[model samples]
Target chain A: MKARVYVTLKPSVFDPQGKTITDALQSIGYAGVEDVRQGKYFELELATTTPEATRSMAADIADKLLANPVIESYRVEVV
Target chain B: MRFGIVVFPGSNCDHDAYHAAKHVLGQEAELLWHKDRDLKGSDCIILPGGFAHGDYLRTGAIARFSPIMQSVKEFAAAGGPVLGICNGFQVLLEAGFLPGAMLRNRSVRFQCEHVFVRVEQTDTPFTLACTRGQVLKIPIAHGEGNYFAAPGVIEQLERERRVIFRYVNASAEAVESANPNGSIAAIGGICNEERNVVALMPHPERACELALGSSDGLVIFESVIQAIRSGRCAATLRHAQGRPEPSRGASPPAAALVQ
Candidate 1:
């Protein structure tokens, strides 16, 4: 089984990198860009074959290790 | 006092901490490898600055799982005095020893310079030697040093006097321009409610010598020694005496924001 995890800063947290990217995009004539928030994506291969089990395991990993609960939130997708 | 400086694989400031403790402060000091489980009966434990675990994933993220951290956690739970500086501060936050998180500097660049930090609370073990509102000059070097937390947490920290340091100007005013990394409320350091664990973003060890352009950092070390000598660190001493451990609980939530 394979899993994908998306980690993003919470809405209340400041995103400096995202802000800079937004500025660069606007400078390049893409003035329509309003807000940009940077995040992390992780793809993992699990030895488990059960999709249900994989999803739970990935979510646990994301909560405990891949994401800091204080500043980040994560979503898990298993396929 | 005996100081134990934990040296993670990528730690670059371990020697600086050791030198500050052993030479500058004239105290017994030892470097404890990250893999070691024993604290060697240290009176104080220091997690110095460096790119621990190569700062992969996130700063201090991977390093928090090192074998020694378990021991560090236990030591702290027993009310031992633990000081985390710079990258060590990030580790403490990740490990849940402290509240909040670090973000990239608002300028989006690595910063390395001496800045003024005003002493906010001197009742804690780490600042007992300094007067409240005294300013110390210390150097900070990091790309991700901005500190953030929820608003409620900030209010609680303020109500309990957990905030210990704030970036400030030469005259000890916490002006906007003086904040180097955009830390909430210009916080440079904070301690748990028990005052046993402290985390600070500045490198006091690097500023302990006059030849290093500042000796102001010595006050912090002196404060710790004074705390120990005066038996103010009753919890840690009680643990050292093999008394029954006190009940432990999670630190209260804290928050801060600079207007």
Candidate 2:
């Protein structure tokens, strides 16, 4: 089984890397982009075959290690 | 007083901290390896800065589970004083000894320069040697030193006088340009609620000698030594001890910008 974890800075938190990307986009003549935010993606190999179990375990892993709850939020999906 | 410097595998500043404590300050110091479960009866602990676990996941995420951290946690729980500098500060946050998280620098650049930090609180174990509102010019080298916390928590830290240091200009005002990493409140260092554990972004150990640019950082090491040797309680009870009171009325301008 494979699980995916997505980590992103909360809306209230500032994302400097994302803003730089936005600036790069503007320099390349792109427009109409309201905002850009950067985040991390993690794909995990799990031993569990159950989707429910994998999702719960991935969420727990994300909470404990993949993301810092203070400034980042995380979502998990089992595939 | 015996100072224990925890040396994780990637910790580069452990020797600097050991030298500051031993050669410079004439205090007993030892380096505790990452896998060591014992604190070796150290009166105080210093977490030295480096790319712990190669900073794979997040800065301090992997180092938090190092074998030595359990002992460090117990030591802090027993009211032992601990100072975390730079990457050490990241470790303390991951270990849950300090509040807030380190975000990427707002400029998205690795900043390595001398910056001024105004001492906001002078009564904690780490700042006892510093006078209130005194600015110390120190060098900061990091990309993820921008400290962030929830708005309510930031308010509480300010109210409790836990903000020990704030980035500031020469005039001791925390202006936007003075902020090296866009830390909320321009916070350069902070103490735990009990005041025993402190996490600072600047490298104090590197500044202990005259050749290192500024010796202002020596005061922090001196304060820790004095605190442990004087038989004073490291943890301030309810934070009601005699703290210098100007911070309540003289909140820094950058702090207001975040709110």
Candidate 3:
């Protein structure tokens, strides 16, 4: 199975890279931008045998590899 | 006193911390690799400062899952003394062993320079060797050193006296301007409520020798030694009574007398 994981900093946390990008976009004449929050997306190909197993396995990957529980939250989508 | 320093793939200050333990305190210290499961019977463990795993994805985001971290977490849970400096501090936060998180500097820059820190509370093994309000000069070099927690969390930390150090300018024998990173309320370091684990942005081991331009960091290690010996004694006593190794979630009463 193939899966995609999206990891983002919690809403209450600050995102400097996102802010910088937002500023650059504004300077380049892009308007109507309110805020930007940076995040990481991971594409994973796994052969976990079963779909039910894939969900548990994906959650494990999220906790162990894809995200840091303290600041970043992650979601996984199976393909 | 046996001490161990964990070496992650990109860690830069592991040797500095090991040398501080060996040269300053004249004690033998070991370096444990990130993939190693054994801590090797060390009384204390340290996660040194550096851009571990390149601080990718997040400051210490990847390193938190290293094999050695599981052992480190077990060590801390077993009432062993643990200290994390700078990037190590970030790893501790990512590991959920410490409260709060590290964000980019308020100015959005990777700050690297000498900074002053005031000892806010000494009820922990890390700061018990220093007098309350004492100031020390140490260097900080990190992109994500600013400490962040919700206002309610900050108030709880204050009420519990968990704040360990705050940035200050103690160079002129006075607390001057703030340091390289603009941390929340100028915080440079903090200890868990149990006070056995400490995480700080400043590199104390880097400042332990005069050739390093300061020896202020020596006392920090000394405090750990004192706490370990005392804790071992308590652990032994508690073991005799068949009690679960006294909780590591609060400061030992004797810690208050350390200062």
Candidate 4:
């Protein structure tokens, strides 16, 4: 199973990289850009056999190592 | 004073902080690895500046979960003094031990230069030796040093006098123009509500030596030492020895505002 995880700074944390990208895009003639926030995507090839097990393990990764629960949030999808 | 500089992966300034505490101030300082849970009997814990984890996920985002941070947070909760410089400041925000957050520099490039900062408060151990409104010339090197917090939180910080440092010009009188990274209200550093933890973007240790052109940063380290020599830091030390936090009023709720 493949687990794709998306990580973003929690709404409470500031996203400086996102702000810089937004400004750059605007300067490059991108229009109608109201706001921008950056996030990360991770594709993991799970060693677990069962899809259920993969999903559970992915949560563990997000909670323990993949993302900081305090300042960031993460979502995991199995395929 | 017993000091411990946290060494996260890719931390280049751990040695700088160690030297500032040991060589500059003539105190005992040690390096604590990211994976080590032991703080090793330190009274003041410093989170040094550097591209920790290469700032891979985000500035300080990846390093927030390092094993050493757990102890660092515990140390701060115990009222021990904690100083976070540059990337270390970002780590403190990521760890939620301090308020506010860092965003990319308004210039969107790595900014490395000496800037002036005005001391606004001297109540905390970090700035106890500083006279109010004194100016400091220190170097700031970071691509994401812009500080952002909501307007309400900003007001609260101001009201509590937690906003301890503001970027200024060489003259030290002018504001805004000295804003290197567009930090809100020209803020260069701030402390927590209790004022026990401080995080700043400038590198004070880098300017401690006479050859560095300015010894403005030396006073900050000296302030820490003075704080230790006095009984003011004893409460922090007692907390580190596992004494329960005095049941004073609950700590104010932390507010977050990211621009």
Full-model lDDT for every candidate: 0.87, 0.86, 0.80, 0.83
Off-target runs (Cα >4 Å) in candidate 3 are A48-60, B171-179, B229-259
Best-matching candidate per lDDT: 1
RMSDs, each prediction? 7.0, 9.0, 5.5, 7.8
Clashes per model (N, Cα, C within 3 A): 5, 0, 0, 3
Could you give candidate 2's per-residue lDDT for residues B89-189 as a string of tens digits?
99999999999999999889999999999999988878998999999988998999999999999999999999999999999999999999999999999
lDDT of 1 by residue, B69-124 (tens): 99888878776789999999999999988889999999999999999999999887
Per-residue lDDT of candidate 3, residues B89-122 (tens digit): 9999888888888877766888878888889888
What's the best-to-worst order under TM-score?
1, 2, 3, 4
For candidate 3, list the clashing residue pairs, or say none. Answer: none
lDDT of 3 by residue, A7-30 (tens): 998997778778888898888888
lDDT of 4 by residue, B200-230 (tens): 9999989888887778898988888766556
Q: What is the TM-score of chain B in candidate 4?
A: 0.91
Tens digits of lDDT, candidate 4, A7-69: 888786666678767888999999778678888789998899898999999988888667766
Query: Could you say which candidate leads in DockQ?
Result: 2
Candidate 4: CAPRI quality band: acceptable
Q: Higher-lDDT candidate among 2 and 4?
A: 2
Worst 10 residues of 4 chain B by lDDT: B250-259
Candidate 1: list runs displaced more than 4 Å: B238-259
State the TM-score of the second chain for every model. Answer: 0.91, 0.89, 0.87, 0.91
Clashes of 1: 5
Quote the positional error of residue B241 for candidate 3 in Å: 18
